[model samples]
Target: MKRTVDVSFPVGPVHPCWKEPARVKCETRGEYVLRAEVELGYMKKGIERIMKGRPWQEVMFLAERVCGICSVVHNMVFIETMEKISGIAPAERAAYLRVVANELDRIQSHLLANFSYCYTIEHETLGMYLLDLREKVMDLLEKLTGARVNKAYMVPGGVRFDIGEETRHAILGSIPRIREETKRYRGMFSGGPMIGLRSKGVGILSREDAGRCHAVGPTARASGIAVDCRQRHPTYMKLGFSPVVRDEGDNFARVMVRFDEAIQSLSLVQQCLERLPEGPVLAGGICRAGETVHRGEAPRGELSYFVKTDEYGRIAEISIQTPSIMNIEAAAHYMMTGAVSLADVTSIFISADPCIACTER
Candidate 1:
């Protein structure tokens, strides 16, 4: 059998559906997409190069700037790596507070990703609803960290500040509302006929493909790979964390996994607060000379930071592996291949939740 390409379709380096810039070239035969290729490098920031020779204090702030959506995880992973090298551990109370902040960040990020997917699929009403819920989560994040994005909350030994009693109560009180609304919106996304028709089986990435491509986060989890960096993190282990999984490996599955995880995050936040111990939030440790690698569960997937510090606690070398790198590759190749409609190309790409800023960083 022979398949002929009837047309070439190119999406982005700039597109309305995508917030960042990256180009995808699709070879198609009418409505059926035969192949797709991704091109990056439009938004490279050279952040790693900038961090070299800087002290840990400066690099910590730069780490969070890697991705605005999941900044907390970057800050956490970098600081934790430095702490490990320095043989410093945070107080138990501070550890729990870190988990609470990280989980809240996860919830807002998942909601934002799902909202983008909904908007891409032409479900504007559902998209708006998800964004509204995300705003509430952002409010909670602000309440905890004093900033919604790029929160430089985590430090070498612990966190920047302690969570006040009133902030704790406010976060606890808000979880139920966020969780219930997320559940209802997920129902709308899953049960709506038009949405189902557009997404249920669209952009399927098989488990084997997901594994071969090394997909991470919800992208891999949706394909039934039960890998989560949090599962190995000490604090998350203490809180009984588990990755959400689905067998569908479709756009719908990916979005649903995020929804499930968002709900799960709410529970994790509640657990952290209820079990939070009364103690000093800052353990106060210096970043001593060392080298270490650390991984954390960002909203998109696994985020890794490798750091080497000199005797003066200045960064001698640094490298960051963001989840978006593999997820974007998987989207452009495995997920976007085969008989996909032209209408679905952008939606399928967005489903993997590619972060161009993180990828080109």
Candidate 2:
């Protein structure tokens, strides 16, 4: 004779492990999560609703509020939407500037993720060191965009402000120094003896599962998907940038992918600085028209936007698909495939940088 037992466990907004307002409930008899459910829309601010009747130029400002960590990506999506509808294409200089901003944001975003991963496994000294090094990137962002959180440098037709001659030289000056520093920091954070033990075979994502689940960014890259939106559809095609990808599909692999990307972004910035052209930055003044869609690669993954405009230069409709939206589901696949502690699992979920506000909007 056999017997059956079922137990349900609740984890959420108030859980000691959580930093945000959301929950996951899992029912299980042993180590496996038999039934897992996600509770969402805790902080749904309805940003899209506010867009109705706002000017096309104003949408970038509104979209900037979607995600604090990756707001530059958000602004790009919104601006691209307006550009499509208005039939305006920015100058080559403007395009290069967008690439610079987007790539810089990638460096900051990847640093934060890898640093947090350092903290997750009890590598205290490395975590602190990585975080400190990350400050260099953050300070650069503040200087470039005025505010670190919502960098409104990307406007409808092109960049809002040009990189000044002095600032441009200063930025060029920092590249080699920042590159050497990041390379050294990356080595230190690898946590030689202890890290391998913790993450090497842990939380594996099989290549088949990775593709079937439609993973993106470093997550998908680690799992052996070569789909980088930047290369797939070149928003900055003139720069002739190539996508960086890898295969291993584990915690360590994901770390490598991000680390390489940061180095590559630094190199790209140098190229952009050298090739930074001089002309009117913007394409033209605002022109309101019908609806259109645009998509680009966010630091985390793919981001897309659709905006409808009326003759009055106001936002008639809007829709957005953030990488977080797709990656969140991929994360759920990881959680379901193996047994993981709440601690090892948390940051990757946030690492998706799921802007509940953007997805919910």
lDDT of 1: 0.91
Residue-level lDDT for 67 in candidate 2: 78
lDDT of each: 0.91, 0.72
TM-score of 2: 0.90
True lDDT of residue 244, candidate 1: 92
- Model 2: weakest 10-residue lDDT segment is 347-356
Off by over 4 Å in 2: 1-5, 15-18, 232-235, 340-343, 347-357
Please, what are the lDDT tens digits per residue for candidate 1 over residues 200-249?
89999999999998999999999999999999999889888878999999
* Clashes, model 2: 0
Report the lDDT tens digits of candidate 2 across residue range 1-361: 2234375565676644344566665556565655455678787888888888888667778898877778888887778777778777877688888887877788888887777676666676776776776787777766666777788888777887777887778778888987997888777646586777666655567778777767777788877788777875454566676776766677777777888889998988888888888997777756677887787788778788878889877888887777766666766556344545544455445434444555565
